[model samples]
Target: MRSRGLFSRCALVLGLVFLYVPILSMVIFSFNNSRLVTVWDAAHSPTLKWYVALAANEQILRAAWLSIRIALVASTGAVILGTLAGVALARFGAFRGRLLLAGMTTAPIVMPEVITGLSLLLLFVAMEQLIGWPKGVGAVTITLAHITFCMAYVTVVVQSRLAGMDESLEEAAMDLGARPGRVFFRITLPLILPAIASGWLLAFTLSWDDLVITQFVAGPGSSTLPMVIFSKVRFGVTPDVNALATILVLIVATGIGVSTVWMRYQQRRRERDVLLAAAANL
Candidate 1:
């Protein structure tokens, strides 16, 4: 047992190292003074030249902006649609075509990105020919594709939360002559907000990190950050690429940290309020 435990620990550490070492190297090399990312000069010192140059890289900056816009729109849409779907499934219980609806809601998560991308591409082409609404693929098209896939994740998160929630709160609100909309907005929505927020963040991350689906749906001059990085990486790693990656890492880490702190503060405040209410009752 001891030997097995030691082996398991070693394997876990090795796996983590394999996953994170490259990312750490990339972050470290972002400040490399040399042009070549792989080369380290003993005589030369690290500099912030690449980071400074990254600011002026028009193509990369545009791609980054496009990615952020798509992610924001797609995640917002996914949250709205997914929340509705989740509410229906969890609250409505048995309804017409319930199983089918549930299956369809979750299908995208299990479906391969390649298949989804190809099908969406065909759909866009058909829509263009039939309605001429979206004449060309670009940010709008990418956002739609992202929403299609991301909603599955959001639905799952919201549904799970709803499943475990106490139905009595909603029942009590209804008993008090509150309309369904009032109950939802005042009671249910607040309770499930954390799940919705997490879902939104997950959807945003998926949309931002996506490359395969975006590649199929994107049009001329609509490359995202991932696409730009991929194009640059084909030649070889550059210091600017490293710098861009490091900046992204910092931004993501900071956002996550701030969100965590905010959530904790909110929880503590709520707990304190509950305690105060209890004391007043006593």
Candidate 2:
């Protein structure tokens, strides 16, 4: 048992190292004074020059800003559509064509990114040829493509949450002469708020990190952050790229930490509320 435990510990440590060592290296290199990201200059090491350079690089800044805008729009659209679909699937109770609806919502989740991107590319071309709208692929096309796949993730999250939720509260609201819409808005929506928020974050992250689909739909002037990074790294990764990565890693870490604390506080609050209600009843 002791040997097995030691082996398990070693494996866990190795896994963590495998996952985070590259990130650590990137962060460290981001501060290196040398132009070569991998080579550290001992004499004038650990400078913020790369970060300053990253800030001044107009092309990179533009690409990053564009990606952010696309992610925001796609995520918001996805959340709205996904929430409606989730509510329908969870509350409608085996209506006609329910299977079809569910399948369509989930198809993107399972479909290969290459195939999905290719299909969307074909779709945009056909639409443009037919209606002479959209003109050519650009940010608009990328945003639409992102929404298409990102909504699948949101739907899955929201549907799963709704599926596990107790329906007694909704029924109780209805019995109290509340209309379906009022019950949903006042009770169901509040109860499912966490799921909705989670879905939005997940969708945003998917849209932000996407590369393959964005590449397919993006035009000459529509390169996103990932596309820019890929293009630069194909030649050689610079310190400025490392700096950008380090900033992103820090943002992600901060978000995770804040969310963790928030979740713990919410859990404790719920438990305290439950205890208080029980005590009041007694």
Candidate 3:
């Protein structure tokens, strides 16, 4: 038993160390004075050259903006569509082709990214040939590609929440003479709010980090942030890249922490309301 406990403790320590080491290195190197990005110096000696250079580079800023735009739109559409799919599947998905539908939903996750990119590229080509819409690779194309992959993640998230949810809640609302729309809007949607929030965030992050699909779909003046970062990293690491990554890490961490706390507070408030109602009945 002692050995088991020791092993578990060791594993936890190692896991934390493994996770933080790279982040720490990146932060440390962000202040590196050396142009080679291999050496760090005291604050007084360190140079702000990379940051100045990064700010001067309009291409990186443009790419970052494009990436953000694509991620936002894609995740929004994915959440709306994925929520409907999740609701349908959890409540009434046992009909014909349910298994096939689920398989198709998850197919992109396991398939090679290169194939996914190529397939989307081809689909876009076919669409252009047929409809003459979506002219070519650009914001619309990137967003469409992101939505294709983001939907699976959103569906999986919302499906998990729906499966764990109590159907009796909705039934009770209905029994009280609430309309179907009212039951959905007032009861089901409120109950699954956390799940939906998580799904949206997950979808957004996935879209933001996507590379292969974005690479294939991106065109002139439409390079997303990852493509720019990839091009830079291929040549060599730069302090500006480190700074950008660190900024993303901070933003993600802060958003997650704030959301988690907000969700917990809401859950607790609901519990309190329920308890108060029960006490009044008593």
Winner by lDDT: 2
Q: Give the TM-score (vs. native) of candidate 3.
A: 0.90
lDDT over C-alpha atoms for residue 88 of model 1: 93
- After superposing candidate 3 on the true structure, give the runs of residues whose Cα lies further than 4 Å from its correct spot: 42-47, 260-282
Q: List the residue pairs that clash in candidate 1.
A: none
Cα error of candidate 3 at position 73, Å: 0.6
Number of residue pairs clashing in candidate 1, backbone atoms closer than 3 angstroms, sequence gap of 3 or more or interchain? 0
For residues 1-282, write the lDDT of model 1, one tens digit per residue: 999999999999999999999999999888778876778864564888898899999999999999999999999999999999999999998999889979989899989889999999999999999999688998889999999999999999999999999999999999999999999999999999999999999999999999998999999989999999888888877789999889888998899899889989999999999999999999
Off by over 4 Å in 1: 1-10, 267-282
Give the Å error, residue 74, model 1: 1.0
Q: Considering TM-score, which of the candidate structures 1 and 3 is the better prediction for this target?
A: 1
Residue 19 CA displacement from its true place in model 1, Å: 3.1
Candidate 2's C-alpha runs over 4 A off are 1-6, 267-282
TM per candidate comes to: 0.91, 0.92, 0.90
User: Candidate 1: minimum summed lDDT over ten consecutive residues — where?
Assistant: 36-45
Expressed as tens digits, the lDDT of each residue in 112-200 for candidate 3 is 89999999988898999999977987888989999988998888888889999999989999899999889989998998888898899
Error of 2 at 121 (Å): 1.2
